[model samples]
Target: MKIFKKSDIILIFAVLFVAGIIFAISSLEKGPPVAHIIVGGEEYKAVNLVDIPEKQVFILETHPETIIVCEKGCAYFSSAGCPDKICVKTGRLTKKGDTAVCLPAGVVLTIEGGEYDAVTY
Candidate 1:
């Protein structure tokens, strides 16, 4: 007859628990790659998100008459001659769903995320 000790079972469980914790920590350490898109009448792909500095000022020059300044992860239409200037009031956008639309200049800014190799494909 084979006998199993309580200490042995506890040791096995503890080892498994520690392994699980380690795996979870490693997975959490991985972050999603960033993406950037310049939205106009159609979606125009921009350079990788890494190219854009975070929490910094950026100027986006569009055709016609419009300029955008992105700061602190949010971009707003700072200057525009559009009749409505609605894009200016749209304010800054930060999250993935956030967007800035410049109707007059026919420009838009959007952010998206997907599995990327950090290299242009």
Candidate 2:
């Protein structure tokens, strides 16, 4: 049996258009500049990616040091002691609230005050 009528379809379209507008407006807004580094599930450090004029790297104190690279308002795993190197492959995180993790090394990097957070749905 047909469930949606003509008016129902138009209403759905209108709702979707409004939602699209809201999403776009929110996406265009800026977010916090801070980035946080966690090692062994603990708060390790916080940094402002925007403040660094040049590229920087850090070695986390893990079983083997975890190397992280910060550049151009983004951070990524340039290299890691983890055997799989999966974290290194996670790629760049530029937007606020972006995250990269190395479970084997107990390391996590997340952008603070990101524009959007993970939604359960």
Candidate 3:
């Protein structure tokens, strides 16, 4: 005697298909998120990336000062006074979990994602 029937197989496949779709969609990010700037290993500034698509420029009053620019939903250090402009060259961080580090300036810019905080600890 067969233990499984044709309907059972179809239902199983359908459930698995829907579950896969739900998982994929849920795993995607909610939307563009804010990025946190860390200075000297301490949280310094929080900027919402979505608002920066206009490519506006600003300054972060770090010890050496960091010039920041936002463009296309990404943020980066355009200029700095550190001996090595590594942070300025690191380029813009756009996606969640993307990070740019400026060791000389003691700055870390990390993308914010999901419910958990990227800066609190």
| Tens digit per residue, CA lDDT, model 1, 15-55 | 99999997565444322333244646655544344456654
TM-score of every candidate = 0.47, 0.66, 0.58
Over the stretch 1-109, how does candidate 2's per-residue lDDT look in tens digits?
A: 6799899999999999999997666456565556788987778888777668898788877875688888757888888887888888988887764689898888998
Top model by TM-score, which number? 2
- For each candidate, the alpha-carbon lDDT, in order, equals 0.57, 0.78, 0.74
Candidate 3: which stretches are off by over 4 Å? 1-31, 51-56, 114-121
Of 1 and 3, the candidate ahead on TM-score is 3
* RMSD after CA superposition, every candidate: 14.3, 8.8, 11.8
Candidate 1: clashing pairs of residues: none
Model 2 spans > 4 angstroms off: 1-30, 115-121
- Give per-residue CA lDDT, model 3, range 1-121, as digits (tens): 6889999899999999999997666546665567788888788778786545466676777768888776656778888988878787888777776778877667788776643323342
The lowest-lDDT stretch of 10 consecutive residues in candidate 3 is 112-121
